[model samples]
Target: MPASSLSPYTLNNGTPTPTAAHSQPGTEVELQPYTGGDSEREVPAQATDRSERPRHIFSKHRKWMTVYMVSIGGAFSALSSNIYFPAIDTISKDLGVSATDVGFTITVYMIIQGIAPSLYGSISDSRGRRIAFVTALVVYLAANVSLAFTSDLAMLVVLRGLQAAGSAATISISTGVIADIAEPDERAGFMGTNAGIRMIGQAIGPVIGGLLNSAWGFRSIFWFLSVFSALVLLGLLIFLPETQRTIAGNGDVPLRGLYKPWSYYFKLPKEWRNAPVPPAPKLEKLSWRTIVEPLTYVLRMDILVLLSWGALVYTIWSMVTSSTTTVLLKTFPDLTQWQVGLCFLPNGIGCVFGSVCTGRLMDRAFKRAETRYREEHGLANVNVKSQHDFPIEHARLSLMPYFSVIFIVSMALYGPSYDFNDLRRHFAGNLVASLGLQFIIASTATAIFNINSTILVDCFPDNSAGATATNNLCRCLLGAAGVSVIQPMIAKLKIRNAFLVLTGIAVVFSPLVWVQWRMAEKWRRNRLGA
Candidate 1:
């Protein structure tokens, strides 16, 4: 916002007005505290659009179109991997590669998934959201198409990494887009919904892959992914408007078709694109340092501890889901790949419920906590609040204890149920534990990640995309490492002991969230001062 438009409190007593020429990143008054009488609340320019304009509006009739569109974008990246899960063995055989070689493809895909979002997020933050989404989708679509054409194992591994580069970014970019549009008050719901949608795709991918592979062959799976991604890309280019508020200047600023890497494409007729548009923030010079900056942020304590807990949570989840076939195959020796895909349904449904339920709960908690904060401080305008001022930790995490209890008890029961060679012998008991375990973990872990990520994104409102990128980088790295240890733990300690140890580890890290929550306000203060 212009200096003249800023509230007086935006600058400390006697402090000079922040000017565009003189101000630096992180120096702007991100949020103007409420000053009764005509003084308005000033949000961080990056996070708060002075103009809040968009090409599309969510009227009551179609309030969720953007969410649905963005969620589709969010889900496809995850869907790309899960859908391929059931077909992996088939692909390995078709390519004359061992099953182990097929597994290595997952490692490569994840490593790239961890790393690629940093670049995409940075690009979206600096350039604009539309182009970045298109670029990533294009790369993903190209990779999938190429994968369908190539049957060689080595090529498959490389193509999978390329696919990761394309698809891994949609989650970060989509989350950034949500932040771009929704205010913090409703963000948890949007985020929760987004997470749920991604999980739905993740949950259904294996089932779709299994059915398609069985009915039409493994090639059908890649073709299907390619077609789906291609459609999403078309929709993004046609229906989805530019959402980077900095560039779009409140949905009102007309967007130019070309932003960066995708700028060279087709030129639409005059009215199809905006006429005159405000210049976007200068694009960052893409380099090795830029690529790794997100990874380096892990050294920061607040982010590190939050991500560490989330990583641990995800590790346990991944271990269970990834090993579904291996663990269950022993019990149901005649299970088919399609049946394996169906087996994933319980976990998927649990995730969907967790995200939606926790998200709504989070919004209510934030309002309640904000009310208490205002009353305790004797503030009149409770509606005017900042992320820093709100009891965000409490708001987002109030249900964590309940979820944690669920995780601990569920894990304890789940592990022991698997001790027997014939799970069918205790099928009902195991099924109950498994479903319950997934439901709780999906809810709890996602809530934790959403809150922690919301914290960082709020910290760098201007760089919400980058903040999410760092979160993605940290969790994915930890998750991959977490996955690597599962087999060793299973081998050395046995399945029952392995899960028990995981449960203990989870309990041990539980304190980190409390510590981080306590420190959030102070950390935020320090961040603004720096």
Candidate 2:
């Protein structure tokens, strides 16, 4: 490429800005914000028009409804995992396998869950969110149907991985849709609501799974999922719109065929119906790089710290939830599958509540941070020049310390709550103790989750899905590790000591959040060479 063709320019000042030509040989330019002037062409004549300002074409109601619609898919993704928790024992018995063998199903599911989203996110980031959503649902629906008919343990594990491959995309895609619609300042509430809904699916899965398993056998759980996913898939086909900016261009661009939501066929105004569909933008090629893009984000120190912090909480929560059935069964040997599933309700409820409250709190924090930034820089009443200059890390990380404390304290108490003998003799019944502790731990973990998720998307606005996939990748791998060994760890060290060890590990890493908060902007600037 020519030197001029490789350069970028600023519109307002006509200043030559840095490009690959300006960077040292062999150094990667990680993040370069769009500077509005392509060196290969003249600046567009219409660029000066204030009336042509780029903005989302969606109405407020439509934006939120779109989020809610996609969240159902996210919920299904989570439900796929959580619903299986209650069936572990039943599946073990029916498949003539040990509980440890059944645990591999969860592990395999999580592994695929971690790996598959990079593909989905890459596709959605380039092709369109609708295609990604539709493809995932179709694959997931087929997987669930297969799982319902399978009797072999090895087949069950393999099918579980296939199921994960399909459903896991919804999570990253859901966050991507939020990025496509909401502004950075307003994203927390939207993300919170989405995450909360997703967490709710995870929360209630065991209850539904237990009920279905107890009444209709473990196969019924897969049957229920197949039906629920088909309904969700129908809803997406009918109502979900293409929101990927590269494809939809703020919702005004006409979409055709699979890219167009069924409702848009009649609901779009006559002008849009009659308008021409522009040639689709070139999509990112599906290659090794696209599949591995999320993994590359792990190389960034700031993202690494943020991912570690979030993954630690996620892994601990996974350990706690996975162990719930085993510990509860040991504590209350007479408890039925339904009762064991019902015990998870409080934890789920807490996650839902925490997500809502923390979302509003994060929005408030953003406003406060923005206000302070404006005052400090003497730019009151004006938006920051660009999000790059804003202190988003501070705004988002403000709540981490408080929530981290809550998580640690509750996590430390969670293990002892499993001690039925002590619980019966001293405080409350073992059931009540365990549920209460689980509730607190789950709620706090969710609050931290909302914070981490919001910041991750804000940092990578263009690649929100990819960023979230990276977050999922980290958490799922760590969670798999935590869950796979939790039983043995608990057996060898005792639940109380094992939990204490987990708590100490979290304590050691908790400061990384602080480190990220303090150093994120510096790291970002270094990458941008600002």
Candidate 3:
């Protein structure tokens, strides 16, 4: 009988039953051949359906909202760190401390900002995203409000540390949230948008702090931060839905129960006899194990290493820009707080433009490369695309030339000049460096998010939140080191030479980009077996 003409049969339970026509004459009909074109057509349709399914409710309208809220929160948190720059003199006078002591406050704040995110990230994995975020914001709000009344320098440092706890966690979790919702192709775009908004806050933060401190006094800056924190908290509580996928684990299991080991201590009940057991939770307790497991995971994962290194490089570059902003403003005494704010406008514009452009370019590059590989090899296209198609090395390689230019121009601007002529040259050189800085950060950030998120999801496909939380933990630890050391390094080396030294570091590491690009194909093949 012709394959198309044979009727399919079913047993009493509705399972498919096979006849002679469906199998070899001497073989059991239960092992039927899949001979029809309909099966082939249906396979693609099923895949297409899975790929095109509507996103979760949290992902639909509130995705961008959450990004905005977290971005704003990051900006405010960052501003709290540096906004004290313009107010350093005032804070010194009011608190009866020297400039060095006031500066120490900034140093303390940076250290806390760096360390807190890693801890927050691991906590988010077990506590749920909403709880982690809301809890952080509440701590930040309390810190800000308390700061408004404190005149003691030590009190300020302690409060700032608590504030950092909230701010750092929010930024890390924000990235995790973006990872949770966006697909590999679209992740760059969303991450770019998120980074751009955060940059906007960063760009505007110093200006706002300068103005508020200049007009109403230094306490006013904390008040302003408090207001911003409150608003973000309100928005998050109202609009931001939880994105943790683990919460969907069977209704019978409590969140705490999932973490405990049942297999070694207790037997499975009758109903659970055939149910599959989940893998052991990386952290059995929230003690050192929680911290150690994430660190170990970061060390073991190649993609995570690439991302950490990229973030470290990017932060080293950022230190030059951030540390010098205040020093640069010193050259222009006539420049008001408002003017300092305006100077940041160009950096903000460059960041937004660079992020959007790089995101699109990265996506196109990945897609084109994938298409060519499929065509040249004469391989049938599969419905599901492998992560191997996205080569992060190319993304990193593209930024090398730009980074070299940034290093040269930034180093050149450090010389003394005559009158306002010197000021104009300084601003122009700084702007150029700032533009390059934005481009490097935007591109590298996109690459890190795309590669890390893809690999992480693949690694723990069933535990996306946990995987992302661990990823956040790694980046945060490295970022904290970057922020904490930048100021001390700048003080020791001076701005110009400090940047030159960093440039040398960049030069050394830039070759790794090429190394990554050359081996990416082979690495992906071996890693994913595509």
Candidate 4:
């Protein structure tokens, strides 16, 4: 690209933002705000021409409705990823490929899930939300349709990667949409809902896939997914308005589009024709190409800490999920495929409960912290500076250790060290432990993610999409690594010992959670110029 094109758009004073890791190899990836969206809460005073501004439509629709829409988008990513799990053996047999080859599809899918969000996030930041959402869904729908028709294992593997690429963006972009409309205080509840619905999607995929495979075959699962995606895309078109603040200006922007209804053209009054056009997305330089730029956030200490913690959480969460067959089947061998699928119900329900409830709690917690801090400091309750200077890190992380410690304990309870099959031989004893473990782990982990993600978004309010993409990258890559190691760890250590090791890792790092909490506020205040 030409140097002119590679440069960040110069603001009024010709302020230069940091160049990316790509093209300019020696240039470090610093956390610099883009020229236009320097603040999430404030549009720059320089650009406040009323005629050029787009309206914000957030108040026109209900907040919960937006959360529900984005949550389903979040859910689809995991749904696409995990939906293939129970059907791996069936697919292997049907395609005349070895089970190992079929399994490679998952590895590829994880790798794509880890990497693809960068492309989507960067583009959505520079382009527009609706286009990115639509593009991802369209590709995802097409990939599912192709997968449903393909009999070749090779084609299936490739399509699986493409399917993952399309779906992963739903998560990163959903975060962007939330950041666009939600104030820092209410963000917790909204982020919690996203995390919760995402967990629901993740937990249910195996069950849905298993039942579909048992009744209709592996192809039917993909067929259903394609149709489901089509419906979601339609909903996005009809109901989910664009929430990218730079382009749309909050929730009330009345931007003209290429796809307007007949009424738009019918408003051919001479007055309407002379009206000013709403400003489109202010595209800055596109230096952050794909996975490279997002990975650079690892250089920032606060981002590095949260992303590391999130990855470990995902590692533990995926570990429990991967063991579903081993743990559940041993305890319930007589259970049908659908019954085994249904076993995940508690886990899914717990995650949903954790996500939404925690979201609300996050807001309340922040408010309480704000109130308490003001009282202790002898400052007025409405001090904007103190509120701006509030330690969001402490607010988000203060209670995290409790949830995390319990999370580890829950993992241990569900592990296969004892022959729960023989010991908890009665279905009643087995059922309670099985369900209880999932609820504890899923709920606790969901709370941790809700707070963690919301704070991360707070840290980089301007770069919401990029921060989320980096979060996805770190967590998924760690999750992929964790998934690859579980069997070997189990083989060498035994199930109990294996889980003990993983739990021990969590135990050891538990204090680091508080350490991150302590350090996060200083780093955030400094970088954000709070």
CA RMSD, predictions in order: 5.1, 4.2, 11.0, 6.8
lDDT of 3 by residue, 32-104 (tens): 1233554421111111233433223343455666567666655655556656666766778898997667766
For residues 1-530, write the lDDT of model 4, one tens digit per residue.
44455444334346532333221231111222234553322222222332233222354246678878877977888787667767766788888986557756766787789888888898777776777888889999999999999879789879989999999988888888887776555678779878888877767887898899899999999999999999988877766666676665554445557222234354542433655666664566666464366668788778778877778887788777666655555556676667666767677777888888888877888888878876877655232212346666777776688888889888777665345657655464567666778778888887787777787687666567877888888888888778777766766777677777888888777766876877877765565554
Residue 491 in model 1: lDDT:
66
TM-score leader: 2
Q: Which regions of candidate 4 are displaced past 4 Å?
A: 1-57, 96-101, 258-275, 279-281, 289-292, 330-332, 373-388, 416-418, 423-429, 526-530
Q: Rate the local accuracy (lDDT) of all candidates.
A: 0.69, 0.81, 0.55, 0.71
Query: Which model, 3 or 4, shows the larger lDDT?
Result: 4
Is candidate 2 or 4 superior in TM-score?
2
Q: What value of lDDT does candidate 4 attain over all alpha carbons?
A: 0.71
Compose the digit string of candidate 1's lDDT tens values, residues 109-221: 77788888999998888777887888999999999999888768889889999999999899888887777766656677777888888878867888898899889888888
Candidate 2 residue-wise lDDT at 231: 97
Identify the runs in model 1 with alpha carbons over 4 angstroms from their true place. 1-63, 259-296, 378-389, 420-432
Residue 265 in candidate 3, Cα distance off native in Å: 41
